[model samples]
Target: MTTTPGDKFSYKIELHIHLDGAIRSETILDISKTKGRPIISVDDDGQETVITDQESLDKEIVITTPCSLKLFLHAFNVFMPIIAGDRDAVFRIAYEFCEDCAKSGIRYVEARYNPHLLANTLDKPAYARERGDFSPRDVVITVCDALDKGSRDFNITVNSILCCMTHQPDWSAEIVSLCKEFKDRGVVAIDSAGQDFEPGKDPLLCGHKKAFKEAYDNGIHRTVHAGENGPSEGVREALDHMYAERIGHGYHVTDDPELYSRCKEDGVHFEICPLSSIITGACPEDIMKHPLIRFADEGVNFSLNTDDPIILNNALADDYVLANKMGLSDEQIINSIFNAARASFATEEQKKKMLQDLVNVYGEH
Candidate 1:
């Protein structure tokens, strides 16, 4: 009658969420205090950076309006530094993320972020050489080790997705090598995220070409950020050039019928973060206008995610509820969750156990 023989169905899977942006607001304040760093630092221009308001940090961290993705990304800079300078900060925030997920009943999550970005404190020798936090490889391992510990402690799974920015082609090889070295320690897949296209640049990069090829050759699963800020062509490039098994926020694919058909036929999955799409203006805040419903109508496989839950002020449960408001039935919403687990980079044996646990809890929707 049941599969996994446990109450694992109380667990859920979230395939896409940014590690840096998803840290709790209260945790940011806690870390800032622990590190003795100013919650408010500034740029060269002297604009006060991060949260200055000691009185209302929670009120301030949550962005409550819609804007372009570029502006939407600025929120990350404020709190990223809190975790960047110290290894302990990384461990605490990452562990807390898993702990939060466990409390929320999220069994597994694929957390993604640029390893280089997290190592910003290590970027300048003048600023970092003395403190000695300056190794990207070490930074990545610190984060992964914390996640592994969290997984064991929380009895929840936290998989890492190392994101390579498309513009910064130089970092690709190093990231792939890091994944290769740390795959056993919960580094499951590779991703290319941020700034899909610029005025003079292609969304797809040659460096990723080499890196993803190596990942493919090694049988590592990969995904790319596309069709959210960029055009549908970027989605095609991800599917064709990088051999991406999943497309991140590919909202614009609905603009092209032929490409939509191709993706559905290929069984390629989309990690759709609805509220993030709304906040970034990729889709309207009004669910009725979103192309997601159309994409679903055409049999496109997809999974709902929070993208950056703390940044978006949403969660996996919130996403499913939003899909219901978007006119998808309860069955469809649950199926999307199932799709998330199926599309995960976890091994087949792991998946089987997870699916059985899930079905025992959820009863195959």
Candidate 2:
């Protein structure tokens, strides 16, 4: 078991956590039971297992070993349908996510998700679900409402980012619109997430490029999932074409010396998820050789994050633990926390307060 970083630092800031991937297993089980939906788990041998209890369900959804990105994402297929398309489930998850973050000593967090994935009204639902009246617009409204209340009730500053699935470039326009529509209502940014780019393929799809350009023109904050499973060029593409202010799991940026130098010189904020990197096979299994070590050595502007806590079966503290084990000093960890606060999409006033709070606890870095 990993030690909880909260024991040492009570105030933490997280920049890259997924709202959908951080749902509680207990909540998933409860939703499945209430909906009378049978939980199915498929094995590597092509065998299907029925998950009836929390134990079985956890075993099915939580990944303990390193796996391909394809296998890691399969965990979502097991339970997303149980919660998606259900208004109460969506609201409850957002609220409970705040509570969980508070429990983990996270003072401020920016959660991200694809609004359409939770909306059943899509002509082709993200998952296999019947059509309904709950539009993607409705999803953003519900999420913003729940996050606002949760932020107040839990005493944590929580904002959300609407994601454009990489494969669904057509959805990008609507996603950017939702980001604008809900900018004051808790939505802070737009992110491009979904499948990784195949080798030698252009990382920035044309539609995504146009939408991100629009987001840029409209003053919407932008982040993109690049260079995690894709090559270093993907990171360059995100910076050049998408106006990405921050990068998600941009480990491979180190692969290109010129690009890496540019990112370092430009102070691009990299949201690095240490455990997620290993589990998703974005980095090698060897912890010591992790790009994070190089990032620390090079003084890269980056922050540690829990990319998918449910699938990784970890909390924010767990990521801190892994970073510590990987040779990050206490000072380095604290620096990352401060980096997150500075790079956050929060308003300047809020960011100032958060930084002051950190200084009060950490005593001038």
Candidate 3:
């Protein structure tokens, strides 16, 4: 196919990837064995008996959804214990994550994770001594340092965002403070992640209002996990309550034309993760039927991403390819790429430079 001037392929950016869920499967297994943790079984018979439903599972093992969220969360349980007490483990994970993104041809990527979850893994003795030392602040710092080092080492640029689990809104104050503390260290935004189906466990509960206010007040960028497992209300809450500049998995907005129009008008970028959505049962069985295309047709500002690459077994290119196969035209693909670049938390100057780079690579005027 003779590509048009505007069809020339160029820059790609993934703004909604999850850090912990992006860890390599083999790497998780290695960490699990090293920590003497029993591996969750997924045998040939498919009789793997991990927690399929959060309601049915023991409280100790937090399983959220049977389809997608359950699997994603279970995957985390396998690795969290292994990497918790060790600083080097956290560093290695961040390093490897960047390496994976670079290998996948992601020039600039923003990976988000809940630092509190990782902080809960501090060395038992160290944590015990302090009694009140349950903090992932150091892990956040070390991981950022490792990411920066890896970025320099691998010739790829990666930024980290500390995600707040919305189930715990009180932690927002601390997370926002951490974002400010590490603003210069590559911690750019705050995110709320986890199963979105729980009643009253909304982004607002996670200090979305306060966090966004703080981020704006501090001149930091803001993003939120919205519209994944809930209705249009969740999407509206993310915008009205949190003032999120970018939305993670805002797929449900498709159900509400008004909100979709609002998103389009306000230029709130939706970080759509195809594989994750499919695997999590958030999307229909067919990729072509995904509402993202409809939203794209409506000119909603959005971009493709791999929310949990490891769990979904996907990458940035995979998403692009999927979109293409699902009938996205070359122009739409290029536009989505530009949308991502523009929606990125990078500064205006950076966005301009990236857009120019895209035009140069794709020959798009």
Candidate 4:
């Protein structure tokens, strides 16, 4: 079991937590029962099987073995019942996410998820035909407000990255417009994630480069989930075609010497989530031989994150312990923390404060 990091590393940062995937287990149960939704689970065979009861609900929440990405995604079915277009549930989850991060000593975190997924519930006949004043834009507003509230109420900083799923419609322009509308609020970046392999999505994304251009032209940072489930070429496409500023789980950059060198030259940071990689079958080996050491050794700029804390039953402190488990030294972990701060989307002032706090805690590592 991974324990929390020791006292030397006092300040923590989370750059890649998914909002829905990180929802509290208690909240999941409450939403499932309250909404009369079926408690669901995906067995090792990647089949959609019911959770049966509370014991299964508890078990399915965390994965102990390598699982299919398709099956892993099915686990999200439980949350769709709650987060799909319900403003109260949206605000509550957003608030609780930041609050929980604060309690974990995460001073600054970037919460990410496909806004389109959250909008799935809103698109239903009941929400559209019955409610006249509502639109998807309002969902964006509510979530941003909740993040702001979480920052205020919990005294921790929270920010969001809107996602554009490659397989789905490219609402990239609409998402960009929403980010611009609330840029002064908590919304910060735009991301390309999900179903990266299929050719249908790639051409669709290629055709919608205007949306990416819109975000880039409007000054929103871009990140893409590449090299996780797909080959390293996805990482190349993310950088060359999509104008990505950073690459999520770009571990496969190492698969190609040129790509690794290109990212190195560009200073594109990798958002590495060790436990998520292991749980989702992205990494065939456990933490010990994970690409973290290789990436660090090769001078690849990267940051450790709790991609889905609730999903993997992992924590940011546990991430530090994980680094140790990977046989990384305390000095390397400290250096990586500073590296993450440098690569973060946080403002310079926030980054300065973070480093200042780090200095006070670890004292010139």
Candidate 5:
């Protein structure tokens, strides 16, 4: 049976979703119109297509089939130019994420994004065309303010994680600082985003490494995107070098028997995005042979997630549907929910409350 929102479950926990990747198409269109920014994107053939409505915008952002990670990332280039550097757009997206989570019965979520990607402070901004007064620090502040308000207004707990892109290790120190500064305002952790190192290639122990160490020293939680498109060695590097408390899309960890055993023994949480794994070519096409099934069968600590709903054209429910299709029993599915709650970076008191709420919904784990 498919676990749709508000169907089988009354409450849920999601740990791996990108805030920028989940923006509503209608919101993007509305913001573009309001700012007088043209909604245009270049197609595979190099022809520019003018997006005039929600349908066209969705066509640009949503991935309908399996694709390489590189192609999947290109979806961001389609609309981020309109959303990034805009204060209202940034706030609205963060706030609306809460509303969407509530609708999906997600009671607690740790939404992550790169503040630098959203800011227009640098001479060469990540997405924005022109430099502006808004800095990465301002992006964190805006997201915190919006998430705080959204959590209160929507009656769901929401927290943010600052991401450090692999290409821009220079931003890692500032990201960790922002995490510390906004700890009271709902920023919970530091994350490594963007591309991962290829197999046999050593993870760059540069500024990113230093920042992660600082976060570890200061009590900040850490997660890394490893072994999704990269090899299992990347997962080893993340754990050994970056001190990752959680592994994001760590499917390829299974490729290393020793590493996989270590992770399972250590209870390292894997944020498994089922639909995303398929569509992003991070795993095999057959659901029956998916790593999530192996994780479930082996009793690995893992949580299902909709990694990028807007891009994947899915919801939390869609992820559950895929898990069900993979023949995961309801017991396993519910266990994944509990796994997410236990692995979350929330405070001990907060985790206690969240675990109690999960038991209330799912009935004694």
Candidate 6:
């Protein structure tokens, strides 16, 4: 499909996606049944209702509700058991995520997950017997292999990042090592994800400095989650201290002009997930009122992404449509795509190829 200069261009690169957050609902049900966990239910109205042995609630518990930051983090905890067990399960999730991306017209993407969380949940009984020395490095490797195979199989490109949860200091070194191990196998970068639960806890406390230093020293790229649930200081810390090349959900940066200016000057990209931000209460209710357009207008480079497409009921197209609704012109939308391509961890040659592909596809009449 040829795109006109004035027409909407679907440039396909997703920089801020979460792996577990992208699992299909049917897959969730299948995994729940296979793992013998509590069955999730749906009402006549077609709303999901998950009942646990520990608690009971009648209404559908939407993960995208605008609540406190803690509640937003709790949303993903429900899916841990469903996604963490078998290699095939992870493979299937990766496959389905890619399928969804294809349907959304996303040509390339970087999906992030903390393999430590997946490993801890999957290897508990086995590791208990082995005195806890067993690493889920194999599982991480398997997931990467699945991603590689899926990319070739589906004719859609996808990359992954071993997200080191900022709350877990003990596993930082191991996660960094995993990134190094998978450096050549399409593991493009490292991420700091999950909730910043404690106010006293520093955003850099998860040994991100050490992890980023190690990854940078080893010639790996870094992207850190900051300013979503914390202050602008957290964003600054990620850039200045942890050496993040990209900041995920940096909505709070609107409050700090100096930090915003620095990011623009340094060419650090921000992966802004609009629907996810609305669902997680990162922004005010309206999309037009979002600070994303302001940032874009100010020349703060960023890419539109579906942070948790499944949970937010969003897709790449949704992000683009919302961008238009937020008063961004076609050229501005194209600029966002270019920002994503520029921030992508793909090699310079690969990036050039992708950019050329985009220009050829969309630049044509």
Q: What is the lDDT of residue 229 in candidate 5?
A: 88
Q: Write the per-residue lDDT of candidate 6 for residues 244-291, one digit (tens) a residue.
A: 889999898888998888888888789998877887788888877898
- State every prediction's TM-score relative to the real structure: 0.91, 0.96, 0.84, 0.89, 0.97, 0.86
Colliding residue pairs in candidate 6:
none
Better of 3 and 6 by TM-score: 6
Off by over 4 Å in 5: 1-6, 44-46, 199-205
lDDT of 2 by residue, 131-220 (tens): 888889988988988999999999999999999988888899999999988889879999999877543464548888899999999999
- Candidate lDDT scores, in order, read 0.78, 0.89, 0.71, 0.74, 0.89, 0.74
Root-mean-square deviation of candidate 2:
1.8
Tens digits of per-residue lDDT, candidate 1, 1-365, equal 00122222356788888888778777778877866766664455887845645446655556668888877776665667666756777778888888888876788788997777766444452122134555778778888888989999999878898988876888899889988988888889999988885322554488887999999999778999999977898888888888899999999987788998899898889999888888898998788988778766766789888887666777677777777778887677767778888999887877887788879877874
Worst 10 residues of 1 by lDDT: 1-10
RMSD of each: 4.6, 1.8, 6.5, 3.3, 1.9, 5.4
Clashing pairs in 1: none
Deviating ranges (above 4 Å) for candidate 2? 1-6, 43-47, 198-204
Model 3 per-residue lDDT at 61? 34
Q: In order, how many clashes per candidate?
A: 0, 0, 3, 0, 0, 0
Q: Write the per-residue lDDT of candidate 3 for residues 229-264, one digit (tens) a residue.
A: 677677787777676788888788878888887788
